[model samples]
Target chain A: MNRRAFLATTAAGAAVAAFPAILKAQGGDTIKVGFPGPTTGPFGALAKDQQQGASVAMEEINAKGGILGRRLEILFRDDQLKPAVGAQRTKELIENERCEFIVGGLAAHVQMAINEQTKKAGKLFISVSQSDEITARPDWGPLTFHEALNPTITSRAVGNWLAQNLGKKWWILYADYAWGKQNNAVLTEVLKRQGGVLLGSTPYPLGNPEFSAHLPKILAAKPEVLVTMTPGADNIAFLKQAISFGMKKEMKIAQPLHWLPQLKEGGPDLYADIYAGINFSWQLEDAIPEAKNYVALYRKKHNEPPGDYSAYAYSAIHEVARGITLAKVVNSDAVASALIANPVYNHYKGKQWWRACDHKAFQDLWIVKGRERSKMKGEWDFVDIVQKVAASEELDRSCKEKGFV
Target chain B: MAELTLATLAAQAFTGLVLGMILVLLAIGLSLIFGLMTVVNFAHGSLYMLGAYLGFFLIGYTKSFWLALVVAPLLVGALGFGIERFLVRPLYGRSIDDPLLLTFGLSLVMVETVRLIWGKIGLTLDPPRELAGAVNLGFTYFPLYRLFVIGVTVVVLVALFVFLEKTNVGLIIRAGSRDPLMVKALGFDLGRVWLLVFGIGTALAGLAGILAGPMRGVYAEMGVTIIIESFVVVVVGGMGSLVGAIVAGIAIGEVVSLTTLFAPKFAEIMVFIVMALVLLVRPSGLFGESGLME
Candidate 1:
C-alpha cells in the first residue's frame, strides 16, 4: 500500500460517487423537449428554423414562469434526414437527455422511424411537418400526434379547387417512395371521383437528378394541369425546367405543398402560376393575437418571419403547457388524455384536437397561388391565399377504416 | 391534338439528345481522369458542383452569366491543379485502392465543406432573359436553354477532339495513357502531362456544372446524384474512350427518354438494366478494348 495506490483508490471512489449527480444534472429538473430533424442535409435550414421557433416558444413559456413551475428547455440534435440516425438520436433524447416530449419532424421516412421509437419509449410526440403515414395504421400509436395535414387531408383540401379551375385532366409527377406513392393514390381517388381524367400519374424515382426524360412524357399526355408531388429541392428543379420548356404557359402547374424558403430559392419568375395546398403560412392577418404576436416576436428576434414549422412548435409548447395545467401531472397518460379531452384543445391553428382514433390533429389547409413578379408587394409576399378547407368538412375516414375504432 | 402522335416521339428524341449532351460533357471528364492517373476520382462530381457554386458567385458579383461560363471552369481547374499536386500526387503509384479510398473520403469532405459555407439549402440561377422562352421546333416547343446545352456540348467536344487529334499535347496524353512507362522512358515530362490532364478534366466537369446550375437548382447533394449517372455513362461507353463515352451518353439518354413514355417508373432503372446486360456480354464496354481499363 504505497501513496500512489491510495491516491488512485481515492480518485476512483470520488468518480463513482459523482457519476449519478452528474447524470441528474445533465437531465436537470426542467421540462425538456427534444427535436430531431434534418439539420445537416438538404432540409437543414428548415430544421434550424424550427429550432429557432422552438426557442421562441421556450422563451415565451419561461417568461410566464415556465410550464407547471418548471422551466422549459429545448434540445436539438441533427438527424441528417436518415431514418437510422433519427431513431438513435431520439433514443438518446429520451434515455439519456431525459426529454419528456418530442417535437418537429421532416422527411416521411425519418418521421416514420421516429414514430416507432417514440411509441416504444412512451414519450409524447408531435410532428410539425406533413408526414403521410405517421398516423396510418400499424404505425399509428396512442402517444403520437400529427400537427400538420397528412396526404389524404392535403389531397382533399385542394382536390375540388384543382379539378374545377385547373381542368379535370390531371398529370402527376411524384417521387417514387411511400410519401410520393401515397400522394399519387390520394390525388387519384379525389380527382377520379369528381369525373376528372387521370392522364398520367408518373412516379419519378427518388433522387433522380434529371427530368428531361420524364417531362416530355408528361407533355405527351397533354394534361391541362401538371401536379408535382415532389417536395423541396426536387420540386424546385422540376418547376424551373418546366418553366423553361414553357409548360407553365401551356398548362397550369401545382404542387401538393410548397414552402416560403422554396419559393425564395426557386425565384418567383419560375414559381409563377403554380398553385399549392398548405397547412400554414406566415401571412395570417386576422385571426389570433398570439399567432400575430408569435410572428412579430419571431421577426423582431430573428429578423425573419416564422414558417409553418415554427408556428407549429410555438403552438405545441402552448398546448403542452395547457395539458400539464389541466392534467395536474407530468405523466404521459395524463397529458395525453388532457390533450385529447372532450372540448378539444383550441390553439393558434384554430379549433384543433388530436383525433384519438388516428392521433392526427384535425385542422385546416389553404390553397394558394404563386404570385407573379409584377404583382408581388414585397419579397416574401409570393403567394395569394385562394381558399381554406376545414378539417371537419374533409376528414379522411381511411384512418378509421384501418382497424382504429 | 392527340397525346401519342408521331410528333411526341420526335419531341422526346430531341429531349433525350439534349440530356445526352449533358451526360457526354460530364462523363468525358471522369474518363480522362481515370485514363491519365488511373485514380478513380470520386470527387469529380464535387468539382462539378464547385463549378456551379463558383458560377453562382461570379454571376452574383458581376451580373453576367457569360463571365461565369468562362471563369468558373478556370477557377475549378486551378483548384484541381492544387488538389492533384498536394492531395493526389502523394497517392500516385500506390495501390489503386489508396487513391480510390482517398477520393471517396475527399468527395464527402468537399460536399460537407460546401454545406458549411453555403448552408444545406439549394441555390438556383435563372437562364438569361434571351434564353428564357421556348422555340417552336415545328413538331413541338423546345426550350432554348436546353438547345443551348446541346450547342455548348458540340463546341466543347469539337474543341476536345481538336486538342486530342491535332496537337502534340493530345498525342502525348493518348500515348501516356496507353503506355506511361514507355512515354516516361522516351524522356517525355509525364508529370506535367498529369497536371494538365487533371486540370483540363476537372475544368470540363466545372463547365458542365455551371451550365446545369440553371437547370438543376444547385445544392450540396446535387453532385452526388449526377455523378452516379456519369459513372454509368463511363462504363457503358467504354472507360477511357472519349468517342465511346459520347456515343453511350446519347444512347442512354434516348433510351431513358423514350422508356418513360411507356413505363415512367422503369425509365430510371432502365439505364442500369442496359448497363448490366451490356457488361454481361461485353465486360470491356461497348467501345472499350479489353486492356483500355488498365
Candidate 2:
C-alpha cells in the first residue's frame, strides 16, 4: 500500500495531465471545426457527399494559408440522422474538442435541435440541410448560419415555374412526414398565388415500396403536373412507377428538391421530363468558371462530381474560412460578426448574399429539366438548366417579413 | 372529392391485388419457417436484402435481369441452408431464446456487411424493357411490371400450395409441424425437414426481394422497410397458417389501397389499427391454434 499503490496513483495523475498536451500536439495550432451528419442511414449518400465537400475545402484552405496563420482541422462525427445524437455531438465538439466553428446538418429536426445547442454555447453553426424553421425564429441567434436553400423558397420557385410552363393544374404525391408536409404547404400556397388549381394530393408513408395503388388515383386527377415531395428511395419508387404507367408522357413531374444521390440511384431516366428548383448544380459549372474550377477540384479529390449538397457543404466551409481570415481571429464572435456584416461574396456562383435578418443566403435558383439519357454527356450529368432565377426577386417573403425578429 | 367511377374502382382493386401478392410472398416465407422450426426468423428480412443486392450485382456482371432474378434467390436459398445448418442447427436443442438471439445479432451482421460491400447509397435495377411500359386494359392503363409482379406471385403461390399439399415432403412437413415427436417416431429425420423448410422459406423471401428490386431502390436498409410489415402480416394471418397469411396479406393490402382513395395520410397507420382490432377479437390470430407449431 505504501510503495506500489503510491507509484500507481502518481502514474494516473501524470496521464490525466498529459491528455490536453497530447491533443495540442496532434492538432498543432489548427482551427478545429466539427462536422456532424448522417453517415449510415437511408440518407448516408448525401451526408458523405456533403462531408467530402467540406473536407476538400479544408485541404485546399490549408494548402495555401489557413485562417490566422494556422492549418484548418476538421473533427467528423456521424449523427445517424438522429436529433439527440446530433445535439450531443454538437456539445461534445464545442465543449470537449474546443471546436471554434461547426458545420453540416442533414435532417431538418437534427439541425433544429443542434441550433438550440450551438446558440446556447455561442458557437458558430452552419446548416447544410434544408430546414426553413432553423434560420427563422423570434430567438434567432447571431451565431447560427443557414447554407442550404429553404424548403418553402425552393418549392415556391418550382411552383411558379411549373404554372407558367405546364398549365395551372397540379397533383401532389408526397411522403407523410414533417419535411414532406412542409413542402406540400409551401407548394400549395405558391400554386394558389400563381392562380394554379390543386387538382389532388396523396401522401404515402416514409420508405413505402409500392406506389402503384396511389399512382392510379394521381393519374385520374388529369392534372397537368405531378409534384412529388419525397426524396431518396421513395422518390425513386414513385417516379419508376409513374414512368411505368405512362404518367411521364401525360404530365410533367415537379420535384421540389434535387438530391444528386437519389438521381444517380434512379438513373437519368427519372429526369426525362421532371422539373425541379434548386440553388446549386454541378452543371452550373458551364455558366461560371469558378463553379467549373470547384467541380474539377472536388472531382480530382473525390473521383466523383460533387452533388448539390456536396457543393453547398464545400462552399459553406470556405465561407467560414473567408470570415475567419477577414476577422483575423479564430473566435466565434469575430467570425459571426464579420460574416453578417459582409454578406455578399463570390465563390461557386456570380454573387450570393447571406441576409442579415434570417442568415439565409440568396443566390440564383437553377430551374432544371431531366436531361435525357441520350443527351447526357457524362455519368454524373443529369439535369439541364431551364432558367436561372435571381434568388432575391423569385424567392417568397423572407423570414423578416414572416414576423421573425 | 372527385366522383369515383366503376373504372376507377376496378383499377384500384387491381393495384391493391398486386400489393397484396408481394405481402403474401413475404408473409408465407415468415409463416413457413415458424411452422417448421418453431424458430421466429428475425434474420429473414436480412436474407431478403441479400437477395436484392446479389441480384443487382449479378445484373451488372451478366447484363441479364432475367438470369439474376432466377439465380439470386437460389443462391440466397443455399446461403440460408448453410446459416441454418451451422448457425441455427446448433441451438435447436437449447432454449428457444438462443436461436432468437443468434438471428437478431446475425441480422445486424448481414445489414452491416451489405452496407460495406455496396456502400450506403442506393443502387438502381432497371426493369426489363418489355415490362417498362403500360398495358392498356380499356378500364385503366396499368403498369406492365406491376402486372408482372402479380403474375409471379400467383405462380409462386400455386407452386407452394402444391408442394405443401400434394407431395410427400409437404406431408412430412405438415406432419412435422403438427407433431415433431410423432414424425420422428415414424422414422422421419426431422432435422433434414427443418433445414429444407428453412431453406425454401428464405428462398421465397429472396424471390420477393428480387421482384421488389426494380420497384424499390436496392439499398442496405431495404430489408428494414419490409420486415415489420411482414411481421404484422404473419401475426395478423396467424402464426403458422399459410392460408391465413394469404388472406391477411390481401386484406391488409386492400385496406391500405382503399384508404388511399379517402385518407392517404392514415394508410400506414390504418394497417396497424386493423391489426390491433383483429388481435383484440382473435387472441391467437385468424387461424392460430393451440400448440399449432409445437
Q: Which ten residues in a row have the lowest lDDT in candidate 2 chain B?
A: B285-294
**Which parts of model 2 are misplaced by more than 4 Å?**
A1-28, A399-402, B93-96
Q: Candidate 1, residues B175-237: lDDT per residue as tens digits?
A: 998899999999999989999988998898899899999988888887887788889999998
lDDT of 2 by residue, B1-294 (tens): 446888888888888887788789889988999877878888988888888999998999999999998999999899989989999998887776788889989989998999788887777788888888898988789988888998899999999899999999999999998889999999999889988998898898888888888887687788886788888888898999999899999888898888887888888888899899988999668987755544
Task: Encode model 1's per-residue lDDT on A1-405: one tens digit a residue.
Answer: 999999999999999999999978755768888889888777866787777787887888889998778888888888989999999999999998888788877878888888888999998888887775677777778888887677777876677779987799988888988788887888888898889998877888876667876776676677998888877788888887887777887888888887777787777887777899876777764565555777887888898877766667777777777777788777667887888885376555567767767777787778999889999977887888888877672456565575675
- Per-residue lDDT tens digits of candidate 2, residues A10-71? 99999999999997787768898999999878788889999899988999899998777899
Q: Identify the runs in model 1 with alpha carbons over 4 angstroms from their true place.
A: A1-29, A287-290, B90-92
- The residue pairs in collision within model 1 are none
What's the TM-score of each model vs. the native? 0.92, 0.92
Q: By DockQ thresholds, what CAPRI class is model 2?
A: medium
Candidate with top DockQ is: 2
Candidate 2 Cα lDDT to native: 0.85
